[model samples]
Every structure is written in structure tokens, then in C-alpha cells.
Target: MFKVCGYTCNRNDFLKKHMRLHSGERHYKCEVCGYACNQKCDFKRHMRTHSGERRYMCKICGKEFTGSDQLMKHLRIHTEERPYTCKVCGKSFYQSAHLKQHIKMHSGERPYMCEVCGKAFKRSGILKTHMRIHTGERPYECDVCGKAFKRSGILKTHMRIHTGERQYKCDVCGKTFISSCYLKTHMRIHTGDIPYKCDVCGKAFISSGDLKAHIRIHTGERPYKCDVCGKAFTQNSTLKAHTRIHTRESPFTCEVCGCACKQRGTLKKLMRLHTRERLYKCEVCGYALNQSGDLIDDMKTHSEEGLFMCGVYGKTFKQSGNLKKHMRTHTRERPYMCGVCGKAFPKSCNLKTHMRIHTGERPYKCEVCGFACNQSGSLKKHMVLHKGERPFKCEVCGYACYQSDELTDHMRSHAKEKLCEVCGKEFKLKGNLKTHMRIHTGEKPYKCDVCGYKCNQNGTMKIHMRLHTGERPYKCEVCGEAFKQSGNLTEHTKTHTEERPYMCEVCGHAFRQSCNLKTHMRIHTGERPYNCEVCSKAFAESQTLKAHMRIHTGDGPNKSEVRGYACKQSSDIQGRNRTNVTFAMKHSNMIPGSNT
Candidate 1:
């Protein structure tokens, strides 16, 4: 046995070679490259590079190397045999040199230091790569795209783009990635491994890039900026998305509806409309949203205090934007206007939705019935029909509705009615009184593009357009019957329940709808509001007046059917020729209870 400097060897030649390190002597030297080594084998291996001789070859991959040890290390990659491992972390390495470098990480020793940035690395190659940042040197270049990278590994990964290759695959999800680093980062999603942590906040992130971005939030540092708007962002991706607004460039487009969006995140949110994917959910209300930002906004509804209050109505709102929008109602201000139709809206989102009418764009769709709509709220409300989920319920009437706004409107019915001073009419809502006043003013603001039909309310115009489009959005859950208007559906649904809420006071007669009871009251009161233009004959019911019109129009019922029908009153027709008189009543196209 031979030993020197606490190192021992069995062979005398190995001991003599080990002694050269203490003596500071290198016997074997390369004259061509000026490389020197104490070991004869290492010196011969270095000399092989000059001669272009790679004697050692891998059996599996046919890769050539100058030495046998180099070939052995290369073979481990194919075999996935990591012989060398660190004691501290138990991390295995293919080569002993890698294990040595990994041990330096455990020791907190970064020997290879960059002089320019004073940054340290465990390995010399990593330090060399770091130095390129200061020098702006990208040594490795791609042959296809001519893109340069600081490291050969990055250049190799970049080449995969041109090659259309995704070599690394996730074992769990089978998702492919270009590089092993990307695969490693993706594995964290399955593993739930948040290794990168912020020292200040103790918040952990899946990747180092996320951790770096999160750290900028604490520092209030926005490195990325838009040239057009001068708006700053924490992320470069956000800045690129912001730049598209100035360019009016919508790069991401929906494959299903062809709706173009400026940002990828916006496109993703739009895709959720087609997919019906609601990932982020509100814990308080169980309301789910596609995007995290929307979920965050919804969460505020539960916990947020009424910080902003309206001066005119004394209404309190959680957000300042809500307060601003509420003020528009009181002022009757429609600030947002459509470019195509010159239609004005109180909110910008309302204007955006109105533009879809001209564009004929309906992005939101129901998965069950193939019902499509321009608005997300419409799709959400439409989904309730299939699910039969009435989340919002009125306490007073026990009326269940899909939307909170519907429940709010129903609750107002129990409250004191808003009075119209001009006509002495009572309304459940203040908006109802305003709409009723339009009848007196003869102002019809909302007009249908399909037809020349006009109405005072926008909602009424929308329902009227359904006559042309044949869009029956409101459906009866009991009978599977559809109606163009929601009020018609509500009235139809009462037939299934056989629940008569409205009643006639005089005869104790019950009616399914309140409008039916109102028409019944006119019979006992002896009021004949509907009058004929030809003979000046008046009738209590609109149907009776409509039947009376057949006398002049020559489209009257058969003479034999109405022979005994000397109808003195509207109820008198019920006893005489009920079938023939009902036929004349149904045929009338004129407005009900109006002078025809």
C-alpha cells in the first residue's frame, strides 16, 4: 500500500501520480493546446482531441468519446443509472463530477464567481452562462431560425420548436414539453411541489419565475412597460397584451364562435362560455366564475362594506364603480353609445352587448338546448331551466328565481307601491312608473330593426323582436312549453300548479292570472271601453267588441250559429253560440280593449 496527503493507493504507479499534486508538477503536457495533467491517462485523453480520435463509443446510442470513463458516463443517460448520490439531499447524479458540484450547493459554496456581476455558481459552466448576460453574448446559434442563446441547452430546446418536437412527457398527465426543465416545472403541478418560496412573505410558488414575479409585487417594481400607453406591468406577458389594445390586434380567436380577443386570458375566459367551465368559485354564495379576477370581484360582494354611497337616492354600494353606474339611473344618462346603430346605453358593457345585435354575434351558448345568446348573464339564466335551480328565493311570496335581481324585483311587490301622479296608477317599481309615463308622452324610444315595431321599454322591444326571430327563450319546466316573453311563461306555469292567486270579489270566482280577474271585473261594473268605429256599438270585453266588428267587415260568424245570440252583456254570449262567438273573438288582430 502507498499513501500521501491522507490519500492511499494499492499500486505504486497510482501513488506516484497522486504525489504530483503535492509537488505541483505536471509531467504530461499538450504542446498543441498547452493543457497539462499529472495522470498519463488524462494527458493521452486530452491529446486525442487534437488528433480527432474518439476511440470510446457508446453501444446503445453510438456516441463517441475520447476516454472509457466518458463513455461510461454517457451510457448512464440511456440506462438512467445514477451511481453517484449526495448524502445530504439523496439526489442522484450520472457522474461523480455532478455529485461533487451538488455537494457544493449543500455546503453553500459557490466557487465559480463572475467578476462583472459578482454572482456565484457551483459549476464553472453555469458561471460562464451567467457572464453572457453582462456581455450580451449569445454564443450558441440556431441554424434554422438564426436565433442565438447563451447556453447550448437553450439552443437545443429552441431547435425543438422548428423541429416541432416535444421529447419530454409527463408521466401523470401525458402532457409533452420541449425541455426537461419545462417538464420538471410541469411536474410540480401534479406533485403540488412549491419549492420556490418568498423569504419576506413565506409564500411558495410552483416555479422560480412565479416567485420572482410575486416578489416584484412586494417591491412595487413594474419592469415591463407599454410604449403606446406608457402603462407599466409586473409581467412581460401583460405588457404585450396591453400593447394589443393600442394596436387593435386580437391575436387569440375562439374556434367555436370566432370571437376575437386581445389577451390570451380573455380568450380563455371566452372559451369558458362554450365549455361552460367555471373553475374559480365564491365560497360564500357558491357562485362560480371562469376567471380568478371575476371570482375575486364576486367574493367582495360577500365581505365588502358599503364604502360608496349615492347622494341623490342614499343607496350604498360596495364598489365605487357600482355607485358611479347607479348614479346614471337617477340622471337618466346613457353615456355609452353604439357606433353601428347610434343606440345609447348607461353602461359600456350594455353598449358592447347591443353591438352584438348588429354583428349578429352570440358567443354564450347553452350546452343542453343549443340556445345561444350575446350575454353571459343570459346563458347563466338559461342554464337554470335545464338544472331547475332557483337559487334566489323571495321570503314574502315564496317565489323562487334563477337570478338575484329577479328575487329583488319580486320582494318589491310586498313593499309600498310607487304611485304615478299623472294617471293615479300604482307600480311595484319606480322604473315601472317611468315606463308608464312614456304612454302619456307617446314616446317610443326602442325600435326593432327586423320590423318597424316600436315600444317605450327596451325589454319590450327585445320581446317583440322574438316574434320575427321565433326565439322562445323562456320555457315552462312542467309542460316543456316555450314562450317569447318571460311573463307568458310565468302565466303558463300557473296552469300546471292549478294555483289561482287572483279572485273575483263579487262572485267568489277564481282566475289563474291577475289579468283574467281584471277582465272579469269589467263584466259586473257594466263598463264598455271598447267601441266600434262603424255603428258606435260598445262592448264590455275586447273579444265582444271584436265579434261586433264582424257585422261590418262581412267576415262574421255563420248566421245560424249566432241566430239566438242577442248578446245584451259580455256574459250573455257565454250561453248563446259559445263556439261561433269565440271563433270571431280569436280572429281579431286589433289591440285588445281599444277603439277599432
Candidate 2:
């Protein structure tokens, strides 16, 4: 207790400090800064400015405080130590003055009354700031912007724009804030400390301002009302955003491209394109994306929720975009047409890749080997071979693959029970069965324009045209090997592995491929597939018939036509009458293995 002007006090030290108001004494002083104060406590607090000493500490939060009052206030948050209680309402508070204010609320007491307007306020600080409105007093001014504010705090906050200073920092997330109040508000997100409670639904909030706004929902109070449309909103920001519709004001603009947008988020997303900023990332595959929409689109690829399924192959996709792209395989729909050759592709990206054929553009280049590809994905997959990196692993088996499609294709090998109903033949994929059915139906959909030769498969037709054009696209890196198609490269790699996967069922003979086994099976079946058009003689094999043709053409190794044994046997076989016995003799001057 302290006393002044003939009032009694408990301690002489307190009386000495209390007399400073009348005596105007400056007894205690700082040694380093030469600053003086009337009381010892004030001088000691000022000395801390030079000493950088924080004596008080909070035990629960491990936060150090320079003053005992600050430590006491912070302790209430953890301990909920409210000592002051209102007598009228029996409400507890952390501070005695807050309890006094609570008692005034029940009594409807406003002791601080304005002299001019007779209006009242509870707090002296509020009344002082409010009196500035009538007095037109803006004492605080900014040094940088020359802006006047009612209080020094507002002036300090405004100075942050020029100074770029953030004094308060979040301890949890390391994010800095310009003001202590904003930092306090942000701490609630990490602490989940809701101090303000709504009386309507018992919903809690971290701030009193938020609780007041939430109460408007229950009361149906629209304080911020629109003038033009006669619409009401609880928040001022919502009203301001809604007014943009009537005003047609696009405030957010891109600095890079001069594009304007209504929302700030849209402008921010557009700016990322010029900056090439990839903020949002995929967790599953570490794929980086610029916008949240792009992240959402990429996340669907990793999801197991197959909303769309292919009817022909039974392949599933998580997104509708992927399923739509896959449907083009069955429909053979090539909507994206090339401008150079008028060749159509199923996807726009595929068309972009096709345009590179004419442009001779291979943008994606390998860093290790300098192998360039038109698509970026091809370059990424090709790099894995150099590193021997197989990231995609099968869950059923321990098999690994370089790409996601390789993993999908490998899964079919584990589930090999799927069979073709037409031929009762087993196939790893349903698409293989559909392709095999083409052989039975003799559906030569693919036709060649040069020689009018038709094939059941499009891939076979591409290989067939390579015979005429002499085009070999696939090349091996280990060996100087080149092939007309990718399947040839695959088969050529097996030479290095020495893997014999195919076997004959009749005999225990093993081969490197199924096609070789099919050729060997013809020996047991005695199936003569090749026939000579000149004499209608069926041969057991194409190579044998080609060799025997030399005897009829007088181009045989014997050179005497082997006494024309080939043509005489062909004419006598099957009891068929020859159109001309001298037909073989007339064609003796003809060349062997010639198109003519």
C-alpha cells in the first residue's frame, strides 16, 4: 500500500515512490543509457533494455518473461487461474478489473460519462480513443507514408508496410505476424483454445469478435446490408465481394501477363504460371503442381477408387478423363487431327506428339546419354534403364517395373487364368483374346496401300509396310541392334537373357518364343499351309516350297531342273488333271524368288 498528501502507507519504500508525483523526483538511473526514473522498479525495467535480461519464466509453456505481470497473465491461460468473481452474476475472471467490469455490466453502469454528448463508456482507454472522433485529434503520424492515426499502435502497424517488420512469430509453425493481436489469434488454431462461447448453440471461438459474428447467424441479423440489391450479409467482406457483381470491378490483376481477375486466389494461381512456382505436391508420388486444381487432378491417378471401367478390356480408371481417353481405343476415335499429314490421334497430347514428326522436334533429352524424345514421359522412362531403377513394385509378387504401365502389364502375368471362350485358349489379357478372335474371323481391317496386302492386326500391317519402306525405328543400346518394331527389340533382349519361356505340348522341346513353337508344331500336325499357284501343289512349309520352285524355273542347284521332278510330282499329286503338261517346261526360263 502507498499513500500521498498526508495519507498513511504500509512501507516507507512505497511512500518514497508515491511522493514522486508531488516532488517530481528522479532518484534511480541507468548506468549504461543514462536514463532516469522516479522509482527503482521502473529503473530496473529500463536497465533490462541494455542488459537483455528476462527474469520471470512460465513453468508449463517454457516461455520466459521480463516482467512478473506478463508471466502472471500467461499463467492464467494454462492454469485457468481466475481469482476475481462478480458478486451479482457469480462469474469468475482472470483479473480483478475484469471482474469489476463484469459487475458493471449486470448493474448497467457506465461511470465514465462524456461531458459534451452525455454518452457513457465502461473503460477509460475506450473513452479516450473515442473522444478523438469529436476532437479530430490524430496525434500519431507515420514517418514513411505520412499517414495520421488515432493511436500510436495503429501508426506502428502502418509503419510495417515500409519497414517490412514482423515482430510477433508463431512458436508452433514458425510463421511471423505483424502484430501481437494477430499472433494471438493464430495461436488458437494450434492450441484449440476457444475462449469465446456462443449462448445460442454453445459453440466456442477463440475471439470475442468471432463469437459476435456467429451470434448473428442465430439472430438472423444482417448488419452489413447491400444498397443496390437490398441483400443482407453478416460479414462486411462478403458485402464488399458481392458489390463487385454490381460494380464489375476486377481488383486483382496479374503483373506478368496483364490479366485481370475478380478473386485474389485466381490472380495468384495465374501468377504461378509466369513464376513457375509449384507449391502443392502429391504425397504418393512426389509429383509437384502449381495450383490446387492441378494437385487434385493428379491425386486421382493414385486413388484406388475406380469410378470408371473399360467394357472391352476391363481396365479401371479413377477419373473420367482417363476413362474417356481409353474409350478411344475401342471406338478408334481420332478426334485430334494433324495439320501436316491429316493423321488423326485419340488425344490432343498424342496429336502434339505427332506434329513433332513433321517439325522434327525432340525436346525431352536424357541427361546421361543425350537421347532425345518428343514426350517427357518417354525420356523419364528411358533414364530408368541407365540407372537400373525399378520403382514401381508389384504387391502380389516382388517384381518391379520402371513405369506404372509396366507394372499393370506385369500384373496380368500373375493372373493368367483368363481364357478365350471361342478357342478355349488362355490369354494374359482380355484384349489378346479380342485380337485372337480376329484370326478366326479373318478380319483384315488393316490394309496396305502399296501392294494391297491386308492383315488382321494394325501392328502387323505396320511391320509389313516396313518391308517395302525399309524403316526400322527401334534400336538397342547395349548392342548395335536395330529392328522395324518394338516387339523385335523385346525378342532381341531375350537373346541376352537366354530365357526359354515357350514349350511344345506334344514333345518336351523348349523355345525362346511361342511363334517358334507354333512353327515346330506344324511338323507333328503335318499341316501343309503353303501352295504353288502354278501347279496347285500344297507344300508342308513356305521355305520348302520356295526352294522347290527353283526346279521348275531351271534355277535349281542341279541346274538341269532335277529332271523336272517338282512339276511332275505336283501335276501327278491328288489325281488332278493338269491344264498343260508342258506348263512347267514353258516356265523353265522364269526366275526363282522373283515377284514376276
Candidate 3:
């Protein structure tokens, strides 16, 4: 019914040739070479290579191409047109194939599969490189080092070393890198961009790999297992290093120290320790540390303000991990069990050292003291005590201490020095101030069970409990003297040491303990909190008030400091006089506060 025109007939022939190009059915042949093409358009483009013809030209950039399709794609860049859009995520792309790849992000689809390993990838190019694992084919080779790579892109990056090319540059730090991806990661420091976040802990990371590792902490999933020892690791690299332990491999050797390590990273870390290099530092305390993890742990100490409470004794510790371990003492739960003896401990290191005790093995030895210990940490602590090292210091009083416990005890002096502005009464301790305030409120919270004896302080009830139980837990290690309370033991320890750690601010006089220091501070403040309820007499100390109460109770005479003093007998006096007579005669020419 219709007649075909000459132009329509020629267009039908051109469409038939384009369909053959898509099918890859090459039929046309070249005369000079053995090159074959499916369509006349490809053969015409190939002839332009010998003729040096550049027909297609870009109007925006004035760039020329031999093909029309290449010119059309290049023009789209200047037009800024993206016709392709992903239906799954509503993401638009300039190309249809790019939109298809974007849909895979939502679908989690990995269509490309490798026949050799049964592994899959979202992209075909990734699967192609993965195939090299079975074939051992490295097609791309570097001219400089002659190192072959499965992917041509890796070889191209390797060639940068021989060419001395640094293409990626950071605008903030002015740092140059060979790869753009590495430069983009380094830029996160200046930008503070943490795109990756953990779903469980709400912790953000700069990189996705860090987020992946952090997620394992919440999931407790360790997929990487060592085949030789059947040990599991959360990270694959850690498992690889653990495998080397079974193989007894020492591949990484330090050039300077001549020390060999199983892992390369361990060798690098040891080199930094030997060099005394502190790359990471704490901003709060100016504490320099060799590793970033050490800096993080140190920051936790400052944030907790050195207040760590033990769950078992209702006592506080300076370290959190110490309190965590001490909690096991109350629950009697030991998670780290010995494999051979079936004995368990709160900490893994404790269990390890305990095993050595049964084996009669002392691995850690003191170089100077010649003392052997089961653990290196125990040896280090012993050495510190031997050296008389006082590293910890109190910030309030500028007092240096040998241990954290001593610093905590020193800070109690500051708490005792707090005075009431209205009453001008100083408290011996914060707890004492709180209890004395309850007296103004008529609040007697602590009631005894035996005689309904009521007191304002819980500490008074604890002291009263000794009457019922007849228990005295405090004992002196120096003189074998027993006490009903810890305060008495602390006071007795001073008699053996003759060491006074607490000192007065106004006067140069020192005291044996913080309680004595608190009593001395009342002289400067002119405040007395303790009162005699019977006669309305006020005293600086509760002991002085107790002595005043004796006057009201008609109990006995209040003894002074020198009331118990007695002169020695004639035989002892004569012996002391004979020794004094001999020493006085010898040191008569010596001046006071001077060597004779």
C-alpha cells in the first residue's frame, strides 16, 4: 500500500549495520591489516587513523574527535544534563549504567560472581581482579621495578614512584600525596568530618574500616580464626600475626636494634619506643605517650577525676580498671580460668602469673636487685618502691607522693580546712560538717538496735557496733598492736615511722596525720564546732569538749597534756645523769644545729 523513498531505503540499510555492531558480528575486512569490523561506521573511523582526519569538533572546548558518539558524550559535560535516575534511592546520575550501580547500594546486590573462589562483587571489574587469585595472572608490569599487578590502575600508581609524580595536594596542610583517596582521608583532620558512625555505640569514625572494627566490640563476633592454634581474632590482620606465632616466623627485623618480630607493625612500634618518640599527647595534662591508645586511656583518668569506688568494700580507688577488678572479689567470680588446674582469677594476667607459680617459673628478674618475679608488672612495681620514687602529686597542696593513695590522703586536708562564713566554725572533715548540720535540723538518722541509742553520724553507729560483735579488724604490722578501728592503727603507725606527712600552713609545725592537721587549722580560723550541751561551753576539738563534759558529768578530773608525766626512779635517773654528764662534757664546745 506504501511506496519506499530512496532516502528511507538507505536509512534502513544503516540501521541494519548498527544492529550488527551491537551483536559483534564482524564481517568487513581491511586490506593492509587483518582488522575486522561489524559496521561501516567503525571501518570508516579506523580509516581516519591512517588519513589523520579529525572531523568531529566540540564547540565549547574546541576539542576534536574522529567519532560522533564520543563528541556527543563530551558535549553533555558542558550542558550539565543527567537523564538517568535510580528508582530505589532517587539518586540521579549522568549515565544509565551509573544509576544501575547506585541501585545496588540499596539492594545489597553483588551480581558478578567468581567461578574459582565462589566470591561475588557488585562490579564486574572487581571480580576480574579477584580471578587473578586462581590464575596467578599479573598482566600489568612496571618498567622500573618489574613488579606485575593484576589491575592496570595499580601499575599506573606504581609508575608514579619512578616518575616522581605527586598529583594530590591538601589545601589546608599543604601536604602532597601520590593518591587522591589518601589525600581526601588526610583532609578529614582539618575538616573534622566523621561520615562513618557505629550503630551500637553512637561512636563516629573518620573511616568506614574503623567503624567496622568498633562494631565488633558490640557484636562480639570474631570471624578470623587461626588454623594452627584454633585461636580467634576480631581482625584478620591480628589473626595473620597470631598464625606466625605457631609457625615460629620472624620476618620483620629491626635494622638499628637487630631485633626480630613476627609482625611488621610490632617492629615499627618497638622502634618508636626505643627512639623515645611521643607522637600522641594529652591536651588536658600535657602527658606525652608513645601510642594513641595510651593517650586515650590517660584522658579517661582526667575525666574521672581520680575517683574510683570499689564495689566490694565501699572504698574508692584512683583507677577505674582497679575497681572493676576489685568487684570480682565481692562476687567471687573469676572469668579467666587456668586450662590445666581449672583455677580461675579476676584478670587474665593474674591467671597467667598464677600458672607460673605452680610451674615454679620466674620469668621476670630484677637486673639490680637480683629478685625474680612471675610477672613483669610486679617486678616494675617492686623496683619503683626500692627506688623511693614519688611520681604522683597533689594539685591542691603541691605535695609530692610516692603513690596515688598518698595523694588521695593528702587532699583530705583541704576538705577539713573548709570554714562556715556565718558561724566561723571549721569542720575536721566534709562528713563531719554534714553531720553537724543535721544537729541544727534535729535529725538523728543513725539509731542503735540494743538500747535505741541515736546518733547523727553513721560512723558513730559503726563504732558502736564493735560493742556487740567485739570485733577489731585493725592491726599494726610494725609492733603487732591491735586496734578496734582503722584510725587507731593509722595513729599507731606514726609512732614506728616517726614520719609526719601533714604540715600547717601558718606555722612550720607538721602533724602525723590529716586529722591532727585539721585540729591545728582551727587556730588560724578561730572556729569551734564542738559544744558542751550541759554547760553551753564551746571547744575547738570534740576531745576538748568531751573533757569539758566530764566537768558536768562529775566523772573525773580532765587531764592535761603533762598530767601523766612522772620522774624516773633513783637508779634510772642516776644512769641517765651519768650518760648526760659524759656527753655534755664532750660536746660542751659544740654549737647548736651544727656538727661537733
Candidate 4:
């Protein structure tokens, strides 16, 4: 027997080989691959990596491994087997070295100590790396450039930029990487295998490292911190990118416009302006978008889920940006400023339309009539004349409308009601009920700052502002006429076309305006809405109230007074207006208090 250090071997050659382990000698060499080992067993294990030989197999999962040690380690995952237990702490581990590391914590035994920071570590390699941090010593330097790295592995990875040596390649995607671990992680994307899952969110990740990173989001933990600014980030890469702002380093440059950016992502985004590349596409609509965010926005048309909601109207929106734009409709926020003219708009699209007047740019054109317009909305409206398209149809009432807004307004009549507590009136919509309650409550919330004019509705206040401002915004291109209200302009346009949509059921007479038709209905119904407070007499029209009130004011004659001086006063009545003449004739006495 041959014995060296508390170990005996059967043969002298075996003892010599065991001595090589302590001596760090690699005598055994493989001719096929450039692999050398201190012992024959290690050389045989290394050979299996090149030979595609996997002899050991897991009994539970039938997973093959090149070595028995590799298979034995993998079985712990299925069996939950931990054989090695720490005698001091009773902390169990699958490997004996892990148990040895755990026992060191209780013993307070640190073999490796940093000279610079006075920090102690269990391993010599970790202590050596810690010393380099205080010294700022990057020993591994690049061959092409003077760029240095702290570790040899980091230097090897950096050299891939110069050499373009992708040692590991993905079998599925053909994606290349410098390391085997990165290739293993890339394989999960093809396999759709997520081993680690978040307990809170149930979001699965490829690796335990990524799972740990995601858990920080739930824990509100930001371990990676910026030393320069003291700002914390979820990711180390984000902190690295943020450091460039403080340094004023724009490393990434746009090749097309020579524009410099702090990050490569910003440069790629800038390049899209020249490339016009729309990579993302909507699955439902086939609408191509330049960015993934825009694709998410466009996909909202298909989804019923609206994450963002309006506080005022209770209207839901898919994206926060759409919700922000919708809130502007309530707040009347006009942030978009016109540079050419000092004008602001509630929306950017509205500002864009206003710019066309200054630029004389009419991009939108009617396909049927070839009528060019500044806005696409105008072009769409113009198309209705040619096609008579009424796409917006009321579900309850068989009525169709050209505009979606008209249909939305028409749908209000069909909606379920909410009762007003003050008036006991049922309003189809909650907003209308709120307004109706305000009328009874005498709450005139919409008040004019200029004239102190108060109104119950916001629309009335808007219309009243035009009186003070003298702003005629809506203009007719046909007759060169303009109006303060858009509704007035819409009615005026109908007169030119001679289109009378509203009709009287009694006389078969048609009117261009719906309000005119409603007034005409009052004649047949004889509904006396206006009542005099003094006389207690009701009239069909409000104009009739003025004529009736003239009796008490000595402006007109009573029936008894008129008949006393009939012929002489009647001639005086003929000189008066038609209203006074009708009053005079209605009275049998057209004499007294009827003097000219």
C-alpha cells in the first residue's frame, strides 16, 4: 500500500495520481478536444460533453445526464432530498460543501479578509474581487482597446464585441450568446417553460434570478441604487443608463440624422422617423403601429376592459393616455400651443386642423366628389351628402343619424331613468337628473365672470360667453356667413339645401328646424304654457301675454270701453299695430281708453 496524506491507495501509480490533486498538475490530456485533467476520471467526464454521451438517467423524470453526480444532484429537486446536515445549526443541504458553508456562520470563521475595507468573506475568490473595488483595479484589459474589467469572464464576454465569437447558440431561434447560461435561459422562451412563479401576481419567469427581481416589485424593494444621485431603481441596467444623464454622455448616435442619445433605445426610437418601420400590428384590425405601446392602445377597440375611468362622466378608457385626453374634455385643458399663431387647443388634433388655415394645407379629400378639406372629420361629413350614409342607428327607435353624436343624444331618450328628489321628475340619464335637481334646488352653478350671468347648464354659460367675447367661431363656407354657435350654423346650412326634415303631423307641413315643428304642434294641441300672474289668464304663445297685459296698463281698450266710442276709436285702432288691431276688434267696446 502507498499512503501520502491520511489516504492509502492500492497501487503506487494511483498514489502518484492522487498527489497531482494537491500539486495542481494536469498530466492526462485528450487528443480529440483541448481538455486536460489532473486525474483520469475528470478527463473521462470532460470527454462526455464532446461525445454527446449521457449515461445517467433520473428514475422519476427520465432526464438524462452525462455524469452520475449530475443525476444525483437533479434527483433532490423531485425527492426533496437533503442528505448533508450541519451539526452546529442543523441546516440541511443536498451537497456537503453547502453544509460546510452554513456551519461557518455559527463558527464565525472567515479565512479570507479584505485589507482595504476590513470585510471578511468565507471564500478567497470573493475576497480577492472585494479588494479590487477599493483599488479600482481592473486587471483584465482588452487587446483592441484599453478597456479593463474586474473579472476574466467579464473580459472574455467584452471581447465578443471585437471578435464576434458567439460560443453558445440557441437551437430554436438561432440567437447567439457568449455564455452557456444565457443560452439555457433563451431555451425557456422556445419551450415556454417557467420554473419560478410569483406568489402574489402569479407571473412566471424563466429563472429564479428573474423571479427574485419581480418579487421586489411587490415588496417595494429597490436594491440596485445609483451612487451618484442616491436614486434607487428596480434594475441595475436602468441605473447604469440613468448615470449617463449626470455624466452628460451621449454614447449612442443616430446614424441617419447624426442625433446623439444617452441610450441605444432612444436612438432606435429616433431612427423610426427615417425608417418609418411599423413593427407592431393589431391582431383584430390589421392596423400596423411603429411601437408596442401604440399597438396596445389600438387593441383597446377590441377589449371590453377599460382600466382608466373618468371621475365626472364615469366613462371608461383602456389606456391612461386616453383617460387623460378625456379628462381634458371635462377640464377643457388646452395644452397644445400653436407656434405660428398664439392659439391653444383642447386636443392636438384640433390644433392640427387650425394650423391648416395658416398653412393652407387640405390633406383630406372626399373620394366621391374630390372635395378637399383641412380635417378628416370634415371630409367624412362631406361624404354623407354623396352617400347619404347613416351608420349610427338608434336601437330603441328605428331612427338613423349621420353623426355618432346625434345617435348618442338620441339614445338618451331610450335609457333607464333616475328620479330627482326635489321635483319627482324622472330623467333618462343621471347627468340630466342632476341638472333637473339643480333647477328645483335653484343651484345656478354655471356663472359668468364677466356679467355675473348665472345659468343651470354649462352649454348656456358657453353660449353666454360668446356674447361678452363676440366670438363667431362657426363659419359657413357656402354663403360667407358666420355664427356664434355651431348649432346655428348647422341650421343655416339646412336653409341653403332646402331640406326640411321636421314635419307637422296635423297639416302635413315640413320645417327645416325640429323646434319649429314642435311649436307648430302647439297650435293643434292648444297647450297654454304661459299664464299671467295678475289676470290668471293662460295663452298659447308668450307673445300673446304681452298683448293681454296692455289692458291693465291703459295701452289698449277693454270690450265695454271700446263699444262706447266705436267708429272714432276704431279708426285710431287701425293706425295701431296688428296686435292692437286684433285686440280692438275682439272687444265689443272699442271706445274709452283707446284714444290715439
The digit string of per-residue lDDT tens for model 3 on 339-375 reads: 8868888898888788996797886777778999888
lDDT of 1 by residue, 487-567 (tens): 888888888889899999999999988888988898899878899999998887787787778767766343334445444
Best by lDDT: 1
Q: Which predicted model would earn the best TM-score?
A: 1
lDDT of 4 at 580: 55
Cand. 1 TM to true fold:
0.44
Across 302-394, the per-residue lDDT of candidate 2 in tens digits comes to 765535788999888766678999998899999999888799989998888889888988977876789999988898799899999999999
What's model 2's overall lDDT? 0.80
Name the lDDT value of residue 172 in candidate 4.
52
Q: What number of clashing residue pairs does each candidate have, in the order they appear?
A: 0, 0, 1, 5
Task: Return the clash pairs for model 1, or none.
Answer: none
Predictions in order: lDDT: 0.83, 0.80, 0.77, 0.80
Candidate order (TM-score): 1, 3, 4, 2
Model 3 residue 562 CA deviation in Å: 81
TM-score preference between candidates 2 and 3, better one:
3
TM-score of every model versus the real structure: 0.44, 0.35, 0.41, 0.35
lDDT (10s digit) by residue, model 4, range 207-308: 888898889889999978888989998877788898987897889898896777888768877887789976565767889876655766676667765357
Could you give the candidate ranking by lDDT, starting with the highest? 1, 4, 2, 3
